[model samples]
Target: MRKLILLVAMLAMVLVGSVPALAQSTLSGDQGANPPESDGGSVRGIITDISGSVVLVEADPSASSGPKGYFTVTDETEIARLEGDIRIRASFEDLEVGQQVQADYAGPIAESYPPQGEAGSIVILDEGGETDREATLSFELEVECDPPANAAFFGFIPAEGGINAQLTDPDEDGVYTGSVNVPKFPPGPAPPGTEPVSLPVQIVQVRGVIKDFGEVKIDGDKTFKATVSFCDDNGGGSGNGGSSSGGGKTLPNTGGVLPITLGAGALLVAGGLLARRLGR
Candidate 1:
């Protein structure tokens, strides 16, 4: 009886050791190199390391069981920074280590240790240690653009291109509202000795009507304008070259996982960089 009891205990230990593998296979439903192709998925977290072209992201602790992931970003992988309604093109160099990011990819997330996946697009979700020269411009405006299909709104710096935000259709009819993000940019050089008061944004509201008259007709467009102020997030007013945080600081090189926050900005895949327009 003593010998049998000892044998049963040994078998229980082996079963416990093998439980994880069995669970993984059951969870993945496939135990090969690829688990199974996911329609598409997104991983939001902070970048911990950048080796060659692979970016190591530390998943948020709130994540079910995923801890860290390796994303392979390539030249073809689209990188964009959200500024108001526009998504500006960003290079790999723009992806500083320790910055918060969201990588959208296809294919099944690898089941291997330190799970890996191929990144199709990576977005800089947080300013992290971006310079003081940049600020975030967030705004919401009321407009009279009717028929959502014939109206568009833009927030720009005039001579230099900025960002664009799209208007939403009204459930109440004829009224449109939108929120935009303009990030990491100064209002421009301040006049000598003059505090950079406010940004003179060319708020262009374009209204157009498409006329398909026997296929030989063209559409006519009319432009309208307004002015608004954008301030930095770091307690600096719209005056004096907007305030910035994390200045003179560099990204982290720590070897630990990180956290992520998302769902506040727009993911514009509407063509390349937001069309550079002045609502003109």
Candidate 2:
């Protein structure tokens, strides 16, 4: 009985002692299991907030709606702030709220709401940065008709009363062309406690219609067609529909850790049983 108690005690000590080494090995393997960054995409928006290595970006609204969430920003991320014709290198500490910026990152971007991907590089847009034009962006379209149309019209959405403009086919060709200037920033006072208006990156739906008959306008007779595009030149940049990165956080492997813990517990239970039997 004494020998039995000694054997159980020795077994428990051996198993318990091995637990630390097994756990350490398991943790080291987990550290290496993190996925590496690959060729990703980009996102441009204003920084609404920051926590740890993550920053919440108010990306341009799109047809596919989702909630705004946090994006991981890390030391490896290349950050820069534009200064009048020069791109000044920046760090994570320099990022601020309300500044319009663009982040280019590695992929494959996670398909979660308010999608996420790590930024390989970030550029802060100055007032007149290369891609930060505040001027009107123009749109053009052409239409086909039998007889030369007496009048043509074009329009886009999200505009006050909807934007409307007359189109012209100057060359007498059935193809008609027209353009509307949309400012990168909406003109008006921003709502109280809100950031300045940044143009939404959307599939701008443009419509064009031509009327051949003068006085009487017939719906069937008038040639109508629609065009759509994701305007990247405006608030949109070369990106994965405005996404951020949370790729750094990966779940650790518990396979090895679990066994180590279980073995230790089993050994302790056997030792207790042996000691209780000896006491009896």
Candidate 3:
């Protein structure tokens, strides 16, 4: 009995230390099918409120159908404010209520009660009704995926009305269509004499995780025609407007941290059980 007691105590201590290590070693280099592919999507609206990395966008009455979606802004995400002529780099610290913005996003949005995806870029469409010209950002997503997903969408907030495109499994192949109506602001500073008041139709930007991404050519296509335009009054520069970078918050790795923690927890439980059995 004494020898058995000593052996059990040794085994318990080994578990207390070794189990966690063994689990980590097993999971360290894991290459399991790389988490599900997050398809491309977008959300546009007013920054009605904000908290953490995700900000709430409130839509006006003319906006399209769909619940107000929350978008996750990442450090890699280009947070830029459109001054008179430039897309100046900024961050969450520059954002505020009533400001109009367009978020181009991709990847899987959270599956919580209200789904939210990460944003790759957040463009401050306008600082404050500085311009009356409505710019449209129109792009068609030619999609191709191995396994089909039920739905994917891209959205944009006009200075007044918001628009979003919803793509689903194609009628023929795995292809789909989507569009965005972004309230137009100047892409960059132009000559002081000419103000753009014409409604321009062109492919401003294309974002998505569609396998074999289709060509999004920016050849200054005919898509750019200004129905109405605004004169360049302010040259482009970064704005001090944005939500704090969470003071260098760790929202980046939040997705991968869960599995590691769960593994550690399981190991601790196993260790406790082994120690209990040994005591008995």
Instruction: Please write out the lDDT profile of model 2 over residues 172-235, one tens digit for every residue.
Output: 6544455554443235432222222333211221212211112211111123333322243232
TM per candidate: 0.32, 0.29, 0.30
Clashing pairs in 1: 83-181, 84-180, 84-181, 84-182, 85-164, 134-184, 134-185, 135-185, 196-240
lDDT of 2 at 250: 20
Task: Write the residue-wise lDDT of candidate 1 on 189-223 in tens digits.
Answer: 43222222233343444422111112111111113
Model 1 CA lDDT for position 17: 97
Clashes of 3: 29
Displacement of residue 196 (Cα, Å) in model 1 is: 18
- Cα displacement (angstroms), candidate 2, residue 190, comes to 35
lDDT of 1 at 243: 15
- For candidate 2, list the clashing residue pairs, or say none: 39-107, 40-106, 40-107, 116-244, 117-244, 117-245
Provide C-alpha RMSD values for all models, in order.
28.3, 42.5, 40.6
Task: Name the regions of candidate 1 deviating beyond 4 angstroms.
Answer: 1-40, 61-67, 107-109, 127-280
